[model samples]
Target: MSTNKVIHALYNDDDILMDAVKKVRAEHHHIEEVFTPFPVHGLDKALGLAPTRLAITAFLYGITGTAVSTWLTWYTMIADWPQDIGGKPSFSWLENMPAFVPILFELTVFFAAHLMVITFFMRSRLWPFKEAENPDPRTTDDHFLMEIPVEGNEDELKALLESTGAVEINVVEKH
Candidate 1:
């Protein structure tokens, strides 16, 4: 398989990186990726990327959590152990629902939190023992890295990047 060629531009400041992204998109160039030491506010909008669907998935996970909590509570308290609940003889699940409110809240939050994290990791292709794909390690410290795909316009891209205050530029041939 053939690998893609891309221009990797390094920026010392987030402001410069943001401007470079806007300029690159304005010129109809696609940015493959950007790496930063910390989250850059509104950087996603500047990059013209689509909004994430994680929130929708989180909603579904929350519903699942509520459902599971309801079912487990019913099976454990009302079905098998139809005895003392909340220091009283509970005859129905609805009567004992107030006591289970805290459990319901905790389980809902737990499932949503745990599942959302797992989903994010799976969607981002992050897993244990994976090698880093960052072109430069400095991005993890202070620098920001932007990768632009090369389609035989290396000189033009380099010039544009340099004009946007890129500190370092490299034409990388990756496999």
Candidate 2:
């Protein structure tokens, strides 16, 4: 089996972490991962990550919800069970659409919200009883951690990380 060496640099502040990331990239170092206590604005841009497609998925899911609700309303009110209430006969779906507005809107929102959540969970590969992938527990509380793979330049990388104001730096072997 082969083992890979990586440098883990810990920072106390997000702003400092951001600057360090920029400097690391400027020096042509590839950052493996960054762990932050909270979401850092513009971090993805700084890391050169591509934009996510979750919004597109959400829009498609919402359209699907609207279609399902429309079909359900038409099938139940106009096709399956036609009722005459208050001297008005349910003969056409368009004419009876105003009365089914609440159901349509409710089901549309319900399906979109529920399905979006499920889709997010599935896309993120999250599931119940899954083990945590955190490298440093302190990152979950108040610290920021940047992981960089070592390429036989531990000293140079460590010096650079120290110059970037890393509070703690460690070189560890990852299997």
Worst 10 residues of 2 by lDDT: 82-91
Candidate 1 Cα outliers beyond 4 Å, as residue runs: 85-87
Per-candidate total of colliding backbone pairs: 0, 0
How high a TM-score does candidate 1 get?
A: 0.95
Alpha carbon lDDT of each predicted model: 0.91, 0.92
Candidate 1 weakest ten by summed lDDT: 82-91
Top candidate (TM-score): 1
lDDT for predicted candidate 2 compared with the true structure: 0.92
For model 2 the TM-score comes to 0.94
Where model 2 places Cα greater than 4 Å from the true spot, the runs are: none
